[model samples]
Target: MYNLVRFLQKHHFFILFVFLEVLALSMLSRSHHYQRASINHRTNNLAASIYHLQSHISDYFSLRYQNTILQKQNAELLHKLALAHLPEPQPDSILKERLVDYIPARVINNTVNLRNNYIIINKGYRDGVARDMGLISADGVAGIIIGVSEHYATAMSLLHQHSVLSIRFLKNDQIANLHWRGGNYRQAEVVDIPSHVIPQQGDSLVTSGHSFVFPEGIMVGTVDEVMESEKGNLNSARVRFSTDFGKLRYVYVVKNVYQNELDGLAKIKTNE
Candidate 1:
């Protein structure tokens, strides 16, 4: 009680001045219409600003949830598109079977500088993802799944040295093999192109759909430069990859519904 008394005595003049200032402002606002209106307008604006800031903070925190929902929607749309591309059923045959399915995944880890680049995703065997499944980004092809655990999967990125993708030219449908040489992550080379087929710059390349991994017409890259083979029998071209591996975040795993049937036929042919 003694300390409180001393403190109040020391600051009494300053405290009185602050109290008087507030009292004077209240009286002015109450007596003058212009002052009251101005004060109310300022208070409303401050409240609005506070509310807007709170709303932005909330949206920032909920971005991951929104992204997950969007990913699922995109996967469903891709599945529908695949079904729509299927051939019409014959009069005697029913078209009740689906050809492929897309599983949305988030890329948790990725590398682009290494000779053997790899991508790690949040989905695995439990999520219906499996080895040899094709991985693609929103823009284009990203990688192929090489291993899977219960809750995670690893993929061999298209930028790897040993990576090879079957690609077809959009102009003439000439098939070629896309290979990486361990340099630029954004560039690759398409080889085994026929000598007679000339690929110009800006030519689009897409998946050939020869294997059960990726579906047909998934974009791969664009021709950057043409390099004719020294032997003159085959040609190759530099390609700019459509998917930027350094910025990869979300991807889709392609699951071929008829993989077992295709694998059985492939094994039979191998035995022959």
Candidate 2:
């Protein structure tokens, strides 16, 4: 108490000034209507200004979140664009065409430097994410879901050793199996392409949509190598993957809303 009194004595003049300022402000707020109105307006303006400043800061920090939304929107729009350019489904088709569902997800963990690496995403069952869904980025397809937990899932990257995506050449449009040799990080193999089509290096390839895993026309990559398969029946080539798994920050998991129906119809056709 003695120390407090000593400190107050040392700064008494400044304290008095502050106390007088507070009392003046209080009087203005309580006395004259015009003064009170002015005070209220000024206070409101200050509050609004602070809120506006805070909003700008919040938006600045949320750019990444906003980008995730935009990326998902882009994926949805691109999927629709690809379908729009495609021919109508067959008259006897069982499943409806041109309708694909998309679940936006962020790549929480990714690795491209190692062979047989898997990617982890920031979505799971709660978000309707499930195993076997096709995962892709804006530049191109990434991989397929192979494992799932309650709130997380893992994907077999396009560069994984056992990864296989039904793909085809874009120029001559020869169907083949896309695989990785588990060595190269940026390269994929397109096997069983008939040599009659004259496969060329740098030929663009995309998803064949022959299976239930991925829809048609998702960009995979360009042909990086062309050679005769060991079996020698058909030509084989290596495709430089479109998405660089090492640099991935965000991606989308494709959910086919009518997948069950489509898969059933596809199975029926294959059996026949």
Candidate 3:
């Protein structure tokens, strides 16, 4: 109590001055329109700044939600595109059968330099991803799912030595098999384009839809160069891949709904 009294005595004048200054300012603000307006203006500005900061924080946290929604929307659009790209002579009922569905997934692991490069994605059989399901990027054809676990899957990249994808000339519809020869990630060779139908440089190649894997017209790449085959009957052309394997981040696994039926028919025909 004694220390408190001494401390008050030492700063009593300063305390009194501060108290009076506050009281005077309060009275001035109440009595003068300009002072009141100035105070209100400052308060409003502070509130606005606080609200803006809160808004930015909210938006930042919602980015993941927005991205997920966008992925779903893109999947729906790609599914429709795949069905529409199906070859003609089909009834509307068959077309509506939804031969293909798209499941969006992120690439958790990938490689481009290896002789047999593979991609790992954050999806599996439980997520509707299965072996032989076709994979594609936003830009073009990517790979095919070769192995699947409950929550993860492996894709054989186009750069793999054993990778084979059926592709067709966009202009003439001439079909050929695309294979990787190793060494280059951007380039693959089309095995059997007839020598007479020369594929000019920059000619686009797309999926032939015969594989029952990738839907027809999904871009593979453009012809970078054409070379004579040692067999002399066919010409092989180097295709520059549309999808950059090194930069693959997201992909869609395509499920061909009618593939089983088609495969069963083929098996029966073979037996006959």
| Most accurate candidate by lDDT | 1
Local error of candidate 3 at 16, Å? Answer: 95
Residue 173 accuracy (lDDT) in model 2: 69
lDDT, candidates in the order shown: 0.80, 0.74, 0.79
Error of 1 at 207 (Å): 0.6
Better of 1 and 2 by lDDT: 1
Which ten-residue region of model 2 has the weakest summed lDDT?
Answer: 34-43
For model 1, the local distance difference test gives 0.80
Candidate 1 regions exceeding 4 Å error are 1-96
Point out the higher-scoring one by lDDT: 2 or 3. 3
**lDDT tens digits, residue span 1-272, model 3:** 99999999999999999999999998756634322322332112333344445544555655675577558658988999899788878567755666688899877667898887777777777898877789998778999877776677777778876677889999999989999898878888886889888889999999999989898899899999999777679998989998877666668999998878988998999999
Off by over 4 Å in 3: 1-91, 229-232
Q: Model 1, 38-127: lDDT tens per residue?
A: 233211233334444554455565568558756875898899999978876664343566688989987766789988787777777889
CA RMSD, predictions in order: 21.9, 20.8, 23.7
Candidate 3 global CA lDDT score: 0.79
Clashes counted in candidate 2 amount to 0
